[model samples]
Target: MNILKFQHEEDFAATGANLIASLLQSNPRAVLGLATGSSPIGVYAKLVEMHRKGMVSFARASSFNLDEYVGLPADHPQSYRSFMNEHLFSHIDIDPARTYIPSGNAADLDAECRAYDKLLEEQGPADLQILGIGSNGHIGFNEPDASLSSGTHVVDLLEETLEANARFFDRLEDVPRQAVTMGIGGILKAKQIVLLVRGEEKAEAVKQALQGPITTQCPASLLQSHPNVVVLLDEGAAKWLK
Candidate 1:
């Protein structure tokens, strides 16, 4: 684990974008494992700026998103696919056909999960995976539990996750109770993991993930076992670590 802490938001976003830009520069066809949420917004914005300036390009890159809210239409404003398009995809030159995000509203959700797992198995093991930590210590939607799933699957949203995401919806009830997420096994297959964490609310979770014991109850702790992980933390998120 390589932990990098930043006191300034600009510095943190810049460093995160630089890492992706460097990866693309070396491997134009790099496979990216992407995540959605507040933690990565700044980094995505920075990447957009770099793309506009010709500092980086995603013309040949392919991407796989980590998760999506179950029961939501792909065109829904809050859907992960929509989120990616609005934030990162639309701004870059990456081909939409090559970008993969699990279908959350498929009639046969079980089959959707299986298909996603199969697709990942055939075309994945992303070169770089960008991740964000849930306050309850989840990575993707793999909530803390006695044991974690090894492939793509559906999950019930925890109260903490629901509350944290409620701000995005008009009411908490509007938030979906389930999600489809790439499991720990798929995430771990990435050649490298880039963990982006911000805000004081994530302080303890970040601490537990990086310094605490390896346990499924704190899902992010699993990253501790990965061969390569780059943890990027803003001051607030690193409050406890300091």
Candidate 2:
């Protein structure tokens, strides 16, 4: 794992956007793995700015998002699908057909998970994957103690995850208790992985991820074994690392 510390979130976002732009420049049809949450919001903003300046074009690029709430509609205010569309997709020229977000309303939830896994196999081992560390060190809703699913599947949200995410919803109860997420196998298969963390709240999680034992307890710690992982942290988030 390669760790890059930035003084501010804006700089962190800039570095991430430049890295993505570089990948897109090298391969127009690159498959991108995306994440949602406040940590990545700045990165998406930077990408949109790059798009407007012709610094990068996602016109031919394909993307797969990491997770979504299991029962929420795509248009739900708190849904990851809605988050991505509002934050990044709407600002870029990427073909909607080339973008894939797991369906939250599958009639058979298990079948939906199976289909997402298949879709990932067909389009992935993502060229680049963007990730955010949960306050509890969970990644893609793979809560602590999870053995780590090998494919897309439904998972119950841990209380920490629910609380962290509740800020996005009007009421805490509005936050869904279950979600569908691409599993660790999918995340580890990315050719390049960029994990972003910011703010003081993430300091302990970042420290634990960087220095803690490689147990399921700190799921993000698994990135230590990836061949091409880049961890970007703002000062506040990196404060506890030393």
Off by over 4 Å in 2: none
- Each prediction's number of clashing residue pairs: 0, 0
RMSD of 2: 0.9
Q: After superposition, how far is residue 84 of candidate 2 from its true place, in Å?
A: 0.7
In model 1, the clashing pairs are: none
lDDT for each residue of candidate 1 in 140-227, tens digit (9 for 90 to 100): 9999999999999999999999999999999999999999999999999999999999999999999999999999999999999999
- Tell me the whole-model lDDT of each prediction, alpha carbons only: 0.96, 0.90
In model 2, the worst 10-residue window by lDDT is 141-150
TM-score leader: 1
With a 3 Å backbone cut-off (N, CA, C), the pairs that clash in candidate 2 are none
Which residue runs does candidate 1 get wrong by more than 4 Å?
Answer: none
Question: What TM-score against the true fold does each predicted structure earn?
Answer: 0.99, 0.98
lDDT (0-100) at residue 25 of candidate 1?
A: 99
